[model samples]
Target: MLINDGLVRARGVRYATASRFAKPEPLAWDGARPSERGPACPQPPSALAALVGNSVEGLSFDERCQVLSVTAPADASGLPVMVWFHGGAYVTGSGESTKYEASLLASEGVVVVSVSYRLGVFGYLRDNLGLLDQLTALRWVRDNITAFGGDPANVTAFGQSAGGDSVYALMLVDTENLFHRAILQSAPLGTRSPERAEMTAALRSSISVDESTSVEDALAAQTAAVTEVGPKFPPSGGMPFAPVLDDVDLTAAASRVELLVGHTADDGSPYVPSREHWEAVTELIFAGGARELARDWAAACGQVATYTFRWAPADAPLGSCHCMELPFLFDPDGWRGAGMLAGQEPDPVLAGTMRSLWAGFARNGMDALPSRSLEFGG
Candidate 1:
């Protein structure tokens, strides 16, 4: 049930909801088909459309906004659409990051939309204010997707880490009817109280501003403070920048989405300052608090399809690190062993297998194909 804020205005001719989700009939390509042999590539400039708009929160400048699209071949009817939010710990990254290239999914007849929202102080610092931004993004997608050849009723929201956390939050407070399914990678449900406290403290210290300071002033102080800290990860526990149980956007309750959640075997090493840091984070994020949180999360999910991926490809480096499966999934040859795709080699077979599984999940509520060694229902 979408509560129209009366702020949403459609620019194009209003298409009836019936035309939005109707199954598309397949079309045939008359020209020479491009090579579908190697990694899927984006079609040339002519084939894609671009969209820009204010965030759901209504905070960002009109020009500083979002992007959505239909990337699949035009002929593919009834293709599923995925709205992807990237992982950056609520601080960094953009929709334009190379790691999120959606060509592979697009090639498989999925319309992929990558979003750009406010980051760091701009998006997350409002105590409970930032949630509106996320909600607005979802609402925008819901109202405008049909124009881009997507099914508004069949959308799936998927993300990694912080983005994954957002997926869960969306399900909880999401009254906009924005998405029907969810995929969460390497993110657990909640944070330890101590960890939350620490994050709040760090944000406060960085700002050095009163808790009651105006959002604009707080953002200015935060930007200056972080610049002095250099590129290092901010000290944890500073501000109420992350999602919290506000009873408005979130109700301190569990969510029910067809969840596909898991962590890589070595998800903690990349941020480790030393072996001890590695051990501590692993204990906290995975074995310690995270494990307990997972139990509670499972209870909330009810009859969920669950799985754990222990991917240790032979070519991977010593540490599997966060986001290691991306290159394998996208099979972007150059991106192999860098950023999220670090510690991976280009494996066509693995890429194909993973893409098919993702597509299947987006198309239906299934986790993955039966043929793949991918496990579920644990």
Candidate 2:
């Protein structure tokens, strides 16, 4: 997307543009429609990718990988937008992954924009640059989404895992009307981020590339392999990269935004080794954290609702583990490659239910139907 909205930021105006991303020149456009998937940022090997043989997890890395995709109905205008940030523990994955082909969601009425941002050291270590990238994208959506037939006033920022953390960050950072709704899906909200120095030292020790390998290449490789299922991830067995909480940002007046936050019934099932405290793990790490955030927001701003996704595919050993509900929620047809979600229970009827709920929130600022612990039994 060509940046046609830079100058507006220099003025005292907090917003960047009426639309952040402009239609690219012919050669610059990657495909017929912006919704066609684009390149992913650099990341290392992922155990998740290895499991499903999903190339997206290990797609070739590119530094200039800030492209985004938008899916919208051909006849629609002034539609609500759902801006998605893909999850990969702050180090892996991309919005370009086919697992996020939001066409069906857009087909239901609203527009969907899946975005890409810098990961690992390029984004977090030297500085909090990844989040800066995200902020820039959100600002772009605010200014340019209208061109894509989206309503700037009715936007919902949502994501799962690391992306969910980013949605939380946006809630904390965006006081200037960027998005009116926020959805946090299976985010490790309570896991404290490790120090950059510690993470760097860990990477420096774990990496064993060829002697001639550049420092950046080694770091990137290590970062990719060091994900949740990887041996070196969580740096020292906990989350590594995170937004440094500025007392100013954390303590900002509560966002004037509604919240729809939730987690899988067993978010920690895959990440945590033992099933003994899996329930506790979910509560301590994701669900409980969201509750605290919701209570805090409800007191400070608008309405808040929380639900647990309890659906399970028959092949799933652990019920509703991390990201197991995503395929049904975003793209049931393209969800196959993610390994975490199998085709066991993804019927069109189920997908339609999820679509109805998500679309309702995006359009109306509240859930059309209250979702308790929703169960998609196999």
Candidate 3:
């Protein structure tokens, strides 16, 4: 184990294996082994680097990226588990990013797992292979997290942006009781995923890239495909690759677990040029979708909590945009150079409270949540 600051950290724990553009199959592991950090799925530079900084700065890229990292308190047992999914609109981002180190969250008496799944044409092109990678990771946690002091039955799946979108999708498809609760941070639920017809056409554009294609060529094809077909989807065109919304009934899924879901107060600020544009995008792509999901789940008898993160440096330009709350939930040093934080320190009290609330939710579900419609950094 890679012990750090009294935490037993296991990095690059492979949970599944897959061929290029194929479905992921679960892999067995002998729990708690030391390994190198997994390479992120191959992709282009993050489109949001100007706003959130380069999260994957030093990471290598590879096709076999179905891996995860686990961090837990040393000499602990029976602790709650928090599985994380990093966000990048299904095209970018990796859970192995330094920006997502979970030491702070783990210090709160929980085990944290950060997942790295396939991305772009390598993942979402043929099918939901990236999501299947997540399912395999959850199964791995169920069977092996006990060795690292996590309670298998009390797993909580949490994510942000595309990652958050992923958690919501997992809630709908999870059948093995893989997780009992979910925390969806800034999930863009209002962004419509491409239908089958659209996906098929997009798939056709990247059809030339197979197992033998150079990684660079494959990425180029992925970009070309998006460029060719993205305009049809308009506002969500930049994020053309997303989880396909199939005919899954949410009523059953909704009733199975408690959920905490919401977005930042100015989630669209970084993406838009004006306050009016920010309001439109924030509502249409973030707030509206989040509120709808909470309402639907609650109406279906599911326990739900929501929040609006309004925290930002006093002179920061983005004003609590998407990803602003992340620094509060993870190790401060990891975000030391993050543009999203605006070079100012996150308030220690606020960071501690965010960690406590998230860990509390992992341990006690809805009971850990404050009253609904809570506002942070207001």
Candidate 4:
């Protein structure tokens, strides 16, 4: 399992199993060592494929995609663990995507675990199965990550976009303290979960599909449902498959976890066709939402930190847009096909600084922060 740069990788490790539309059950030992990256949850093409490259290209898909990948230094012991949940509006993207390979972060002296959960109708149509899948994965890590040299108690749950939202959501439900710190990048809080009545109506649109339906028919039904319901939730309504909002006290849960959350300078740029529209979207959705969360967390607890990544490749049209910071956190080469990078790799010094800051946070929580608010590039 040892790979380049002295890192040991355990790919396609099954953490849990679930039947269609059911909550996941944790699996401690599957009787077989995982060697290949498991299939991603079946999903349609990403809406952001033109911005970030199509991550699912050439990747396999299945309903049973509750797997995680681990990468750690060959000699690692008791290292801080950073568990990643990829972002694709909770519809697409997988932890096994090359764009998410953790060699760079692993080389930075921490253990990284990338997770893949169910997506789309299979995950969110009638139940919060995907989020439950994440909780199940966390439980698996708590019970077994020690074998991979990660400190179960020193875990940092971090993600971007929907994945970032997933991390923020996890803070409210992680009553067992599975992770002590969180990093949320470009989480679109402006599009909060719809009211239960609204969600119920939306779910009704896909009532024709069920556990026995063919995957193609299910996906078609999901698309039809979203098309019918999207207009009701304007602006960010294009995203309907979201975490179901719970009755937890946001202030209390956010206060307990050390948090570092923020968005890119142009996070909404990729969604709009022009600079003006993009600017408006960025402020209304990404920037404003993250700033509001940071303010609320700071008022409730003193352990919150925030940041803004403003760096973009020179002349890049999507300047510092969503997913821009990912190249710095992982291997830039992995994102070579992404249009957002403009054929330019992330600056090495900046990438190093970002990685160090992230790894340090995993190691020491908010105390590792250089400041309460930080700006990178531009």
Candidate 5:
């Protein structure tokens, strides 16, 4: 019932085929087919949605999202692998988010795997199940990426926002060669990661809804409870959903790998008290935290590179706010969903620079890399 042409054939100088290599669901089954995009982890509407013209509302979200997509150049073998994680404050986003497209990056001679993991109450309400989900996905890539013409040995991970925090988690966890390098963009590392009991207490104390709360009602109430507080959320009482430092698996060796970390200039504006507060937060949360991680890695293993993105469109009211660099790094043409953060059109020169830097890191392992890490607003 099968034909050779259907199994393996090409058009336009490239041939591609995909399969659901693993079924991570509770109900495991084999012979998974590659047909459609996986569901995104569910989440409430983002507040930034209003400011960004509700463009973020229409994309996609669902529960069955613990999957990954790999794209590679044709005629490729032993190519490095770059797995990507998108950011939505541990609540929103998926590997399918328009911002994490892997085509452009894969075109540069590496296998690009965009991963989706659990989020929100499904992830961190009790323990770090979402993080565990990410670990599982990474393990899958480590074991099977070679089938896609990728080099299992030269795996690299890159993430942004909450995704960036996940990358940092890889450094603290016992990765054991799961990946050889990482890139963290706009990671909120300074945010406090409390111990397990403390974090659980924060969640318990934040919302009062009992079992009677419908799934949708509970999700709404929980989102309101956490966001009602001022910009710097998960306030004084507890942290509803953040990584617990104490739960780190100490038995596994601490990860040592070349790292690249960065944040945009106005990263804190929409989340801080005033313009002045935003500036202070940028110093404390982004710059200071990057320096600490860099110094620690400098002492531990391979070299570290850090950058600050100061480029903002002339008319941008919020300046180079959180995740402003994503469009430049991913797809400038398809980044309209980014709204005001990326402006009408992004800077091509800056895009080329970032593309080169990231691809080089994915290839060369930080032994030799560019240094103009900071890009002042043009």
Candidate 6:
């Protein structure tokens, strides 16, 4: 049967089955018939090899939580594995977003897994409760990836924006060596203090409570207030809740992972323009400390693998905005109207270049520079 947006479904799960794409086969049970459902179930259409959607259950801290896992088919010569975290300020976003398609990356002969964890008020509000959900998700990958044809040893952790911030935090907490390599895109490393304070103040302000309020009482009150606001509150400054450096989860430590960091030319523009709200956006999000944070981040990331792209199209109203190069990097088919790729087919030159660079980093700790002429050493 056809699923939403032309995806094919057999049983209850949906599978991407375009003729240009190979169909994934269902996972086999350990000792039962092929028809028997296993703990880790996969999908159908044998051409694609494997596509399994499983969950890592019984998390230690949060009883109701589970980390969703998406495993792709293996490569012809056994490619590496990349565990990707989606960027939505750590408050919003999931692994299932189309913005993070791993098909192109997987085609490079590497298994890719996109992770989903708790978000917003749920994930980042740990007091002394010791909730290491993100780390737990990583541990789950380390333990279970082999079942999905992935090499845990060669895993690379990569993320953008808030996800990128998480990557750096992972480094600080001695989890750097867990992944072979790391890629941080458009994230501010040194700006966490102010940003965390802002998030805390916003959360406190949302509840109209003081800082002395207990975690449990604050959470209860906030939940009630939010419910009064009707299910989900309207998107505002109070929504993108992130982690705070409570001397536990985040600490002062040098990063040990091989880092590849870069920023777009103009990552401060709007995707959809509104003349009325333009002034406000310019004054708030794009002004003052936000601008300085990017520069400060570059300065702080000193001597790491750094490359800056000033991508701009003559017809485009703005230069490279936040997430502008993602489409090119991922080679998404529908992103033709984005940045430099506007009204054109996916450029093989760019796609191949990025794939090779990223693949080399994943395979080894070193970032394979795309061009020798481009200076990557900060």
Task: Give all TM-scores, in the order shown.
Answer: 0.67, 0.79, 0.96, 0.96, 0.82, 0.62
Clashing residue pairs in all predictions, respectively, total 17, 9, 0, 0, 1, 2
Candidate 2: tens digits of C-alpha lDDT, residues 121-210: 545553456676677777777777776678999998999988998888777777677888888898888774344345555654555554
Q: Model 4 over residues 1-378: C-alpha lDDT tens digits?
A: 546678888888899888898888888765354668778999888888888888876678889999999999888899999999999988899998888988888887899999999998888776678999999888888888888789998999999999998997888877888888899999988777444347545666655877799998888887777777776776546567877866646676665688899999999898889999999989887888888888887777647888999998999988899999999998877788788888887899999999999999999987788798999999
The C-alpha stretches of model 3 lying farther than 4 A from their native spots are 193-200, 203-207
List ranges where model 1 is wrong by over 4 Å.
1-63, 188-220, 223-240, 247-256, 273-280, 286-298, 312-318, 331-344, 367-378
After the best TM-score superposition of candidate 6, give how far the Cα of residue 232 lies from its true spot, in angstroms. 22
Runs of candidate 6 with Cα error greater than 4 angstroms are 1-65, 71-78, 127-131, 174-176, 188-191, 198-202, 208-240, 246-255, 271-303, 334-346, 370-378
Instruction: Give the runs in model 5 whose Cα sits over 4 Å from its true position.
Output: 1-35, 50-60, 193-199, 205-214, 227-240, 247-255, 372-378
1 or 3, greater by TM-score? 3
lDDT over C-alpha atoms for residue 200 of model 4: 47
Model 3 misses residue 156 by how many Å?
A: 0.4
**Poorest lDDT segment (10 consecutive residues) of candidate 5:** 9-18
By TM-score, the candidates rank as 3, 4, 5, 2, 1, 6
For candidate 4, the per-residue lDDT at 58 reads 65
lDDT of 6 by residue, 1-378 (tens): 212222211111111111111122222223211211112111111110111111111112221222344435532234567777656555444554445555666666666666555544445544301124455556655665665556777777787766676766665554435665677776644344444555555564565433455445645665654445422322223223455654443222323445666665554454235534543433343333234533444455522465555554445555455565566556375354443444544446666767667777777655366542232111
Q: Which residue pairs clash within candidate 6?
A: 23-48, 267-322
Candidate number with the higher TM-score (2 or 4)? 4
**Pairs that collide, model 5:** 40-62
- lDDT winner, 1 or 2: 2
Off by over 4 Å in 2: 1-36, 50-60, 193-237, 248-255, 371-378
Lowest summed lDDT across 10 adjacent residues in model 2 is found at: 7-16
